[model samples]
Target chain A: MSIEGSSPKSLFDKLWERHVVVEETAEAPAVLYIDLHLIHEVTSPQAFSVLEGRGVKVRRPDKTFGTLDHSTPTLPANDRGELPYATPEAKSQVERLIENCAEHGIELLNMGDPRRGIVHVIGPELGLTQPGKTIVCGDSHTSTHGAFGALAFGIGTTEVGHVLATQCVLQRKPKSMRVVFDGLLPEGVGAKDMALAMIAQIGADGGQGYAIEFAGEAVRALSMEARMTLCNMSIEAGARFGMIAPDETTFEWLHGRDYVPKGLAWNEALADWTDLRSEIGAHFDKEVHVDATKIRPMITYGVSPDAAAPVDALAPEPHSEAEKHAADYMKFNAGKPFHDVAVDRVFIGSCTNSRLSDLREAAAVMRGRKVKEGVVALIVPGSEAVKHAAEAEKLHEVFLAAGAEWREPGCSMCIAMNGDSGKPGELVVSTSNRNFIGRQGKGVRTVLASPATAAASAIEGHIADPRPYLFAKESA
Target chain B: MSFDPIKTLTSRTVVLSQENIDTDQIIPARFLTTTVKDGLGASAFYDWRYDEDGRPKNSSVFNGVDPETHKILVAGSNFGCGSSREHAPWALADFGFRAVISSDIADIFKSNAQKNGLLPVEVDEETHKKLLASPGAQVTIDLETCEVTFGDGEKGSFPIEAFARRCLLDGVDPLGHLINQMPAIEDYERQR
Candidate 1:
């Protein structure tokens, strides 16, 4: 209630108040209008089936978009028209999605379509995810779209069908949390590192049922791409959504995107988006202040996102039973050096960290280097568009020359739905969002790191710190 | 087939002692096959159900007793911490578990549980410890009163969203609710 001189409202509170389509019972969950509904193949087949069973047509086809990811292949289809997926089961899922979206009249961004990308990536790049709107997808990483100050969260496929049918979702209001990273970030640390550091401070489940907003000088200084990387993994911190106030970086990134408002409409949209900030005296249910300068390049040694620390730090002691299990699962011993953990493979792409800028970060690290012997390094861009841009800028050459495979875009090795998985028990330094057991493959050991860290580890044959290996251009 | 409405259940609790037991551990992503919703129970906890080479792990609850017989799960705090997979609840429900009792539960998982027929009962730490200590204790969850009783008859009331409670009691989902009240909803829309 920012009625007149009422107390200053937080970012989420303001956005929440503006987007409620229906005011239901007092303190009851409200019917929130969803501005954008992103659907991907892996999670939507069941949702569409549910819709068909109910005999409902999609309510707002214009507002909904579909893309083939997760189940799509990084390698192109063979001469037989069969996708290069390990399982036909995966291929059929994406095929079902194509049919489902076509039947519903929703736009499906097929592979090799320049617009086709990770749903999260394409949503922002096409200017679909704007400030002060509500977004949902059947996938959890829909939180990635929240970087633009949108209230974005992932819903289950059941809710996905509901949103498709009504464009409105029944939701309980999430409490507000503001985590401020004050001061300047230390050198060699970027958004991914900052994300890991934040998770370290707040455990995996710390931000449950909270719409978290990042604020302060450190967050403000990040590039829009970096800010997206930060917000992308906020789900790992147990938040369905995370936001950063729309400032110059956010506006600049949105300015000329494919569908951004133009001319007077652009100016009007900008004015509205510019005001999407927490009031100076905003109330937050929980507030965490981080000394950004103290943060260093971070990495996750254990299975969960919260089992993270500074790259140079040793493995965490197993004080808790969960830690013990994670250590056992990872085949890692406490008190061992983090970087000494050898890796057999390295993957650089995901909705979490696969964009033009993320590729550039890895390219810089790979420029004058070579991937270590026996390391199967790969660079899969977030979209075909990102891949084309990287190729034009010679980032692809840089990676290829350094022995990293430049593959087509999809969620390659991210969820391992595609055939791009490392051998079982093979340790991998991956840039994907999850480090869950068997997430990459059966019994595959995953160590989550930033793109730069992943590149450096590829070159070093272990989980090496990227600070010492940053290219002069990157450091400068 | 439509889900059966779970009004009341009494059974020995299956204790899974570990915090932050994520959805992946509940059901790994690899087993997330089939657009079909029913019968994911056998695949649930696929890894925990079996050892590395494929034999069923002796320590697993699935192997120990019929999951259908033990209708309640007493897990450590922060159960279902990762991913928003509704499959987790579907699997648990397929196994005939009516409810999950935890000191804390992730927001998405709890919401997913509510939408499905599985009830989530959040007990205090002390109550959780007693339940964990006395594994197989006859825990009875009364959805009518929102109370979970076990551990020598000590009981605690867990809060449920009033809207969700009504739906669960009526054996309906949100889709069902909207369908049932379509006329009233359209009238309200027209008034607006």
Candidate 2:
């Protein structure tokens, strides 16, 4: 069981070696069996159609889970939305998923079910996302499930169809990139800040063609929610996926859950998790280290996630070819101070930052303030579970009282897949990952900021420091 | 449907033109819901070839061109940017684009295209400019010689990693081509 003599193997190496189907060759790509396949309403239709066209059924239906989240309307507790069930598009898509799942006998956590939420959020909450699992979804944010020590990745519809029919995917194993974040984060900094800071250090395409393994003290100490945020932005950095090794934090999050094994089986699972860490001396193709303490409250100022600046720093001056190119496209003034930059809107939601904690933080800032005039602030929770949790804490009331539009759970305004979008030329201070041009809407500029910054920006109508609120609260 | 692979690509002169066109833009998020066959051909250049009116915009390079006649698409640097949607290549293939000439391509998009039967040809900037200037210039793409011949009989050499080239010449996808290597996989499994 030892790896290459007495040297200890990193959890990544162990899991990869354990799941090695065969070494890649010139003609043949390695085929790795998937442990879990999470599907949403958006991307499963074509995959199902492909299967039907081929007269093929899902190969491992038992390993699959389907749900409706991306397009589900989040209505207030008192008033249900106009749509009785899912939206027409969502309903049709969900129907396709349900029919396909039934035909294949796969589990479907349809909308309105307590377990149904954003595919990323629900997977971990229900304990279906576990260590050493190979999780694939049709959404890029599928990397969010890798927080549970699983090798999770997103696939397109064609690949989804391939997986449905074969239970395995033809994949070229990615080179491992280790991103080690050490030391404790300062107050006002959260997982979103950490992820943004990482993107800031490494340009958006730094991890291209690589699978990032997030390690070190900071990553280890992150809660399951925070870990999900960390892995959620793997695609933002152009990495195939980002993963963390399973530990007590991961097991604790999974325990007592309905889907998780209990009693004697739990202990057996723990023993299995012990082997999930990367071995000492295990080699990585690339290694990046970011000092967590050095990271500040971050905000993206341009088209890409990497086009970011610290809360206290001015907008970056592009000296390099890549920076100049991105800056020209983004129309951002080089070396210009970003402190007084005006914002037309503030959005707090996405697979990256729409959790209960993110809502609570934004609520804390909006408790006694109203959204500034001409500034539209929207708070969309990541999932129904998160929305429910926010209601339980009265965070929604705080947001609504502050004139913020508290919308339902979904990837609202994240990529503007649905009707939720920002107007062209509007400057949006978003908590979502990626500030790329037209990422929110055509010509709508996005400035990715922390939740506190987003809330403050909504209140002030410009980028402002969140530390003052935390400091004032501390003094009180 | 089968054609002579040896005689098919007589001209290797592929033109390269668009920049940072992502896979999502190629197939778009909407078309992703339909069956591959139903959605692939018409949706290849959905956004690029049409105006907001859904009419074929006259300015679109791909618009109004006969599919069989337009065998090559010259694209600018960093083409195929967004999500790793393999439908990009499927759409490209269905549109009768045998090869995409670009300075560079997104990693996943390139791999997907190569895996599925589209030849992604990478060339230098100067060479790309020259190919673009050669309007309606059909290049003799010889899979056997692995070279692209311009209209002027100038041949520009390009490297297609041995395996990928072999797969393209054989007219088989990577997955289908791998059937020949099952014995090695079986032996490895036995050892394990």
Worst 10 residues of 2 chain A by lDDT: A77-86
Which residue runs does candidate 2 get wrong by more than 4 Å?
Answer: A1-8, A74-91, A317-331, A474-476, B1-20, B27-70, B74-78, B90-96, B102-104, B114-116, B121-192
lDDT of each: 0.84, 0.74
Top-TM-score structure, candidate number:
1
Candidates, DockQ:
0.51, 0.27
Residue A143, model 2, lDDT: 86
A349: Cα error in model 2, Å: 1.6
Measured on C-alpha atoms, candidate 1 has an lDDT of 0.84
TM-score (chain B only), all candidates: 0.89, 0.83
Q: What are the per-residue Cα lDDT tens digits for candidate 1 across A1-476?
A: 44654878788888887766656685346777778899887677777888898899987899898888777788877888666866777867877887887887998898658889888888998899999888999877888878899999989878888888877788878888998999989887899988888998998988888989999899999999899999998889999989898888889889988878999999999889888999898889999998999998888988889888888988878887788888988987688889779899999999988999999988888887899999999899998888889899999988888988998888879888677888889999998888888888888999888999999999999889987777365532
Candidate 1, residues B114-164, lDDT tens digits: the string is: 877888888887888888888788988888888888747889878888887
lDDT (tens digit, per residue) of candidate 2 on B96-179: 777877766656677667755677777777767777677567787676776777777787766665666666677554433333
Best-performing candidate as measured by lDDT:
1
